[model samples]
Target: MYVINKSRHSAYLLHAHIVFVTKYRRNVLGDLHLDAFKTSAAEVCAEFDAELRECDGESDHVHLLIEYNPKVQLTKLVNSLKAVTSRRLRNQFTDLRAAYDKPVLWSRSYFVGSCGGAPLEVVAQYVRNQRG
Candidate 1:
């Protein structure tokens, strides 16, 4: 059930599993916060011609599965997602903003894993068996 994307010259499929943790590992997110994050994440992914396949989280961290185009720079997308979500959440929930002196929601670092591709060993074996 993987659909390949075609550009003017190339075809590819790319996905990223990203994780963001709350600043100081605070347990501030609840149902309302998670819902808002999902909505905002979908909108942000749309801007980059990507799709947010799934999103879920606990009180302290969130996870997102995104299918995206190869042209998108992973780092920039992650930064934007964090910044936009943080700003929106802080504005929507005054109590959340009050918990921090500075405007911060997610920690500075994040986890991003590339997914949806042939296994590494399989690809390597194929290359080794190449005629030329």
Candidate 2:
């Protein structure tokens, strides 16, 4: 007789692709060092126990697709990411503050979407192609 194992359930995963834009669409993130900023953002994601799938953006906005555990709070994660990135960017690049034309690195609002049961590779590709 063969027995079935009903308790072997797959873990619940939540993939979130978030976009944080500068206030008033200012081009504070210069093209010369955009890659570095993306790297910093990825690091922040890792620190929060999230998989940084992809990070990309123009001078005015950033797009990040991250895979996080279901137990984490979405709002808390976003806020921490924004705070850390903003502080790091300001300290590393002084010109960013001057070019910001505002007191904030990221706008007060953000865009977040939940991707459930979708292949992570597909979501990563979409984020990577957001520049186009």
Candidate 3:
């Protein structure tokens, strides 16, 4: 479940579903790097006063459910998250880095969408829903 954040001027519960894929669609992520990746992403979120509520990913891409302040620009957050996480992940896993032909870990493109109105659980379920 998620909670609302309130300040002197406004109360909000803005959530962004962010997806980032590996460069050239390389399948390099594995179980060993997941925890480290999550910790690094959470740290990035903290820098911008956002909360990393949920994070999961397949071998080639990742999904982040982040609750953020309205004052934060969504694009900058995504860029930092990708930059920080990729740098850390690459630094931690030398083998994984060599596995890719390019030095960059992630691609230039990403997907981000906001959730609203519905209960937190429903929105979360929608994010976790599988595409068939």
User: What are the per-residue Cα lDDT tens digits for candidate 1 across 27-68?
Assistant: 999999999999999999999899999999999999999999
Model 2 regions lying over 4 Å from their true place = 1-10, 100-103, 116-132
- Candidate 2 lDDT (Cα, whole model)? 0.78
The digit string of per-residue lDDT tens for model 2 on 1-132 reads 212213245455567899999878887676654677677777877777777778888888988888886556889889988888888787778787776656568889999998656478987999999999
Clashing pairs in 1: none
> lDDT of all predictions, in order shown?
0.95, 0.78, 0.89
Cα lDDT tens digits, model 3, 17-108, are: 99999888888889877788899999999999999999989889999999999899999999998888888988999977898766688899
TM-score of 2: 0.74
Off by over 4 Å in 3: 119-132
Q: Please rank every candidate by TM-score, starting with the best.
A: 1, 3, 2
**Where does the lowest 10-residue lDDT sum fall in candidate 1?**
114-123
Model 1, residue 98: C-alpha shift (Å): 2.0
Q: For this target, which candidate reaches the highest TM-score against the unseen true structure? A: 1
TM-score of every model versus the real structure: 0.94, 0.74, 0.85
